[model samples]
Target chain A: MKIKTLNLALAASMAWGTAASAQTEIEWWHAFTGRLGELLAAQVEKFNESQSDYRVVASHKGNYSEALNAGIAAFRAGEQPHLLQVFEVGTATMMSATGAVKPVYEVMEESGLEFDPEAYIPAVTGYYTNSDGQMLSFPYNSSTQVLYVNRDKLEEAGIDPDVDLSIWENWDEVLTQLKDAGVTCPYTTSWQSWVHLESFSAYHDVPFATNANGFEGLDTELVFNGDIQVKHIDQLGEWAQEGKFIYNGRRNEAGANFRAGDCALFTESSAGYAGVKAEADFDFDIRHLPYWDAVDAAPQNTIIGGASVWIMEGHTDEEYTAVAAFLNFLSSPEVQAQWHQDTGYLPITNAAGKLTEEQGFYDENPGTEIAGLQMTRNEPTDNSKGLRLGGFDQIRTIIDEELEGVWSGQKSAQVALDSAVERGNQLLRRFEQANR
Target chain B: MEKRVIFKGWMLPALLLMPQIVITAIFFFYPAGQAIWQSMFVPDPFGLKTQFVGLGNFEYLLNDPYYRASFLTTAIFSTLVTVVSMGVALYLAILADRLIKGSGTYRTLLIWPYAVAPAVAGVLWMFMFNTRVGVVSWYLGLLGYDWNHVLNEAEAMGLVVAASSWGRISYNFLFFLAGLQAIPRSVIEAAAIDGAKFWTRFRTIVWPLLSPVTFFLMVVNVVYAFFETFGVIHTITSGGPQQATTILVYKVYSDGFVGQDLGSSAAQSVILLFVVGVLTVIQFKFIERRVHY
Candidate 1:
């Protein structure tokens, strides 16, 4: 009798739940937290309120790496969500997982929605596009490496706050000045591999890997240990020994030191604006990532570093329609402009970039447009387009390990980067073998 | 003579053991078999294609310098964790056992740290040792010593071992306290009357008598350090500073889940399983003889 009543109650609840909403529910597993999470949630809420056809339920699924792993596990279990937010490093993995994901271009075509590939920023979209000229994922939150400086720290160190920090020659002098002024941590950085290696190679117009960074084929080799890259790291190693630059962890753990007003300068993602604005009390400014002035073709455009939204497989046709509609909504000029202005992420669409400019955002905020200017300043060569090597996440770890050896004075920069290239190439070959 | 109560029929005994047998088969044997099967093949991330390469993953792991170095790292890490945690717990247990008053409060206080999860303990220790903002490191900085575990291999290994051993000390403390309490007061008093000082009595009588518990804890703690301490390592060092702290279990996690190299991870797990099997066998066959119950 008790079991019968329990079943009756459960049946009633199920009926009531279905009766409550006729709208189709779309699940989006994202890797956003804190303020960015709130904004993403607001976007979903606004989309849901704007139309009654679909209710997008966006949930935070830890950080980028964790969210991708969750998606993989869920897909293996045949319970994947409708959409997943994957970091740029996982782009190759997701693209190779042909059975686990539905391409965004296909989803757009099937939804009968007004979708145009030309609308997205070229440098941002190029990273996720296949050789066949099809976009694999929706470029949701694109960011480029940017230098963040504490203006107060600069002034306190008796340096001109208006000095040009765009070039590495000037930046090195500034680092030395700050150190000479008794600054303990004159400079620090976050995402060392991303900023120093990937973005550095792009900004200098050097290939980070062969096969145009794996766009041509999967059989690519890591060639980031070239002369320019080695010289850059060797200089950074010298700076470390001289107390001009401080070595932080592999990831963004040094963001804390920068925000806590301990470091004078930081090289981090442009998306670091949100955290700087929220947690920092000192005056800070975002600038273009520095380039070595010795190189002839310096100051080439930097690549994107943020995540994209992937449509996972095993969802219904109706859900795919909703996903396409939501992606369109997210890329709308107004929404994209708002996201760019709010989070310091790049406006994935050219229209959104124009929209942000027309609203007088750059004029009002001095450093807000640096990321945009840096990315769009030059036509991206094959070298500056960005990398798409498989197992890049592990390769980055290997690079981090090698770089740590250099920073600790245990190994020379050349030797360390050579080993990194060798290790990374092994991973690349293994990836090529498996994916084939 | 021991009293034996036999079941009337084989059906009764079999029925009683069915639940355990079924659970073991489902949880343990099934996963072990799957891991072994998967180790022989490399699959793409989506499981779209699979390439069979029997023992190829193991061969690669053996040839890879990093994987071989990880074996040494794991040996060093487990030995340090077990020895440090057990030694500290035994010392504390002996101290707490000698106190005639407020022994309950002492034991309770000692065991409370066990309630904290390994991950939480790792985070706690990481915060305290953070180079930039950590209080302990800041104090160390004031003393003219730089504590940079991010680039310092020895420091990184030390920090992780300390964090991994922190919560385990509580568990070992609980067992040691119980074993000390279970010892008869008359034996200890008789030792003391025989002109044996506290140290001598503890060395001769208490230490030998406590061998059974010590032996049990050594095996348990070794296993814990091998498998369960991945949480601490994952939270603390993340097998960093040039793979200085990459234990075998941590490597397995990073390779499989983070790197998405399933076949290699499976091969690593099989090797880890064999190692633990050998350890358990050696402990039971040889060490058990020395342990008096």
Candidate 2:
């Protein structure tokens, strides 16, 4: 009888251990670090605290490229996380992974979560949404490129700190003012291809490529070597020669240059606000990107930077339910509003924006609304909507090379642009053929 | 019966090797075979649908100007970096060998860079060579050099090679130092009796004895320059100033991950493998025979 009781106790303990170990754990891989990483962790903690059925574990894989590569490698190894954060440029590649990804709208519908695509701000949602108006991915930490002004530098240069830089709609006027103020490093930009080429084409209402920048189809050719692009690049080349615009190395290396008060004006992403806010010892403000006022419809919306959350496939129904729950928690107004206010990323959903406005955050923080205002200023044309080109990141590298040639006087702007177009078209053709 | 039992005894050793054989099959051989397989095909970035086109990728790569440039660039970069680093490392190794006191301290200091991770090394070099805030750039400005890598291709390549050599010299120094220490005191004492000066002694006895170490370092350094500096190039230049620094491995990374042309990238990898394989085989056949020890 005593032996039977001991066996019962042992079996009961084993059963309890199994029950404890069976709490559906979901892995979320992201690319955020520092402040944004902390916020993400807090969000995950809140979600985990709200529920006892599932536990969400978020891991900082690496930077954006590293994280994306890790996710791809993990997927190939059949150990993919339930959620993956991919940058905006990786949208096409993520979309192509049909078997490897679970579309967010489908996940929401399958899990019976209260998901409304329209609840997301159209300007932000459209980037990650399909043509049929379905949310393919969850828009997280979306930002548009904007002009950052070092007010103290402007004031030091004897230029009016409040001098309506917003009205100087063209590069010519901006350059003139910068030159007049003796702003030697007045006009420097980050992500030169993104700011000068991608956003330039959009702001000028020109097609960066055919087939609606490959949103419609993959067989798109490079069309950015047009007259406007040439003229703009030539002018920038002239500025580079004059030492007014310096071409720092690629990828936000110039952010430090601008933040250190070495450069008066900077063309960088709205998300740069976080770093600049933390590091810059001087007062600074964000403004709408300057446009070529000569164009018919100048100052159209800018395209998005930052990244979105992608739901991977090959998980159980229970995991999908957990993903849906986590995503819903992420999209909640309170969570999103706090995230936007903290990170300088655009609030992805309309409810979040409304909630932020109700709290008068915009009134207190000037120019925080500029990015949203500029992106949604007009109904997005086929040209204005974000690029969906395959092999875009590589093409951007090519464009960067050509633009560097222009800056360095190795090639004329026209010659460089022509060569870049030709070279880039070959890639597009290859991409088209492969995809077909 | 005895012979049969001896043959059966070999089965134990064979069984012991099973795990390693399986691991190599799964990890190394499988990936290499897959790369060779994938090189013959074109893959869709989105669906990753691969279609075999047998030697098409190789043919295209041979014809592609960018690939050709990358090959030439890789060869030149590898050669320059290996030679320069070997020269500097040999000089430092000899200098440290002469030090009777604090030789260990000097050796430790020299080998410190080898202990740093490649990514950290890249970042460290970036800070030194950065255009705006780099100490090197700052000093160059004081010296009235252009110092702007954005505009100057020669300067950019020089900077990359210099940085690569700086990071690599430590490893070579360590090897050369060990080889220098192992050189017999009798050989050097005999040379001293002949009244050989420093350069004379170095050129005659020391250099010939160090040739074997030099040859080994050359092979390893070439491979390091080809593969290891890709991160530095990506971080520092992104193969910029008109594709001046786009070496083979950088192109492979850009093509595979950034370009999402996995087939073409794999094709490039196979080409790199071929080149490195040929070089390695040539080294073993010709160069290895020349090493004294």
Candidate 3:
């Protein structure tokens, strides 16, 4: 009797498996690794299991830049996935690739799915939308810059670990104190261009580029070397000379130093919490990114630095339906809330943020809500909506090179920023020509 | 004396050469032709539209000071990598040639680095001299030396050069060792009988005999340093410390692959191809005649 029951169950499972195999498969290539990558895979698995008609298969295609390149290469060769995750820097490039990407608005409208653009957080969604208020991509895993404080290191320097270092002036003072206490690395940062120039401009409500920071026109030029930007970098240059601030590299290399408790203070992406939480053995806290109190709209807001998922062009109608389903599944409040809480990325949808709050996640996690709150704190001005310059990835490298000169005492901040602006504008022009 | 094999029919010869011709066309000429074509126009990332701007990319690169600066950096980098790698390999090959006991182990160890990938070798060398975590930097710090390659231009250049040359030494070592062993022991023995010391024999006879191998390795190493060492530069310095280590090939990769500026990158590749072609021609024309063989 037991053998007969086992045979019957096996037959039933085989029948179900055959039925499942008939599901339309949707392919998604993303740029996530470690904890986030695992969460992304689990979400796909859940989505697939939750439905019987469509199966979304998620694959890690290297980091942000690599995935974007892969997506383009695939599209050129007619092998692109149904959806792709492109980092914020690639927004202009992807947007200009008019024949390659299917705008999210069209995808929703075509699939007859309910998608209110207003339902998503404006600060995050605004970056991927056009001037006509049409959403082009799904803003996924959005993160803003935050200050990571190694409390134990600060306390050892005879400074109160929680003494409200929310102003740049106060933070500057604490840096000196930490350095005086023989701290090797008093302060450091990852993504120098992002933390300094990009988010810095947004935080002060200054233009990083002309043409309303590239939202208004393709002929936009970079003007990040403004007086405010120069002054801030000059201050950082002075700090570097005084052995207060350390620049490890252009990317997130300094995150390792901070996570290892070598740096007392670090300015990095709020997404850095995932790594810091796992790797740090010291007492650490995530706090608001410091602002210069002198600026007119002081502490206006910060820009997001993560990636968005874009639907590609050229697919069967049935495949489009499957992609639309998976996208809706992704933006569903429960799934997005789980993603936001697990990865420390800002909740994309207002409903998800509300759900997370109602679940008491923010109250329980302490400081985990800082990223979402920082983004939503202010009504985003034209300057703070986020830069949409073409060839921004290359421009960031130019900024990095110039900033390296400042940090190394090779060039004054004025000269360096000037040079960066000049060089970056050339790239912007090239982007303009190509995109036009 | 040519010892050339003669084929019986034209059909056989054509068939034999067909595979190589096809491969060269597919792998080398096709991509090069595409680069030259792409270099003449600015294409949108989507491949939907391309704007013809003949020689525009080249004009921009030529005018760009950073791209111009990369030429000098490439020159300095390739020179250092070639000299240091060749010099160390020659010294080790000489030592191994003289060794009788444990010579196999010594030679094997010398050639081991050749097996390591360029990126892996870069990481290994970078790990040892890294400012934050490297043991060497730590020791240097203990000695009152602040070793910061990230901010220091000279240190960044030095780090990339060392990392690039470290793996290349094994390849040079193998060639040098083989060349040394191919020289008959009788000749060196005869020289020693004439009261010639090691230095005298090496300078007068062994050096002349090793000239052919040296010439071949120099050409190959120069080419390797120029095109291949970008991996080391990318892994260690990433062409920074304010473009102090921005070698030409690395810039090509940064602009084309990472930045997705196809026209600029393609122009850069075309220039690189021309450079390597000129270098190889210069070596064959001027330096090859000096080889004793």
The order of the candidates by DockQ, greatest first, is 1, 3, 2
TM-score of 2: 0.90
Residue runs of model 2 more than 4 Å from their true location after superposition: A1-25, A167-182, B1-28, B44-48, B187-192, B284-293
Model 1: residue A213 alpha-carbon error in angstroms? 0.4
Candidate 2: give the clashing pairs.
Answer: none
Question: On residues B162-273, what C-alpha lDDT tens digit does candidate 2 reach at each position?
Answer: 8788868999999999999899989988989999987898888888898888888988988898788887787777787778999999998988888778888888888888
Interface RMSD of 2: 2.0
Q: Which candidate gets the maximum DockQ versus the true structure?
A: 1
B124 Cα displacement, candidate 1 (Å): 0.7
State each candidate's chain A TM-score. Answer: 0.94, 0.92, 0.94
Per-residue lDDT of candidate 2, residues A242-274 (tens digit): 777887867888898999988888999888887
Q: Rank the candidates by TM-score, best first.
A: 1, 3, 2
Tell me the lDDT of candidate 2: 0.84
Second chain only: TM-score per model?
A: 0.97, 0.92, 0.96
TM-score of each: 0.96, 0.90, 0.96
* Candidate 1: residue B163 Cα off by (Å): 1.3
DockQ class, candidate 1: medium
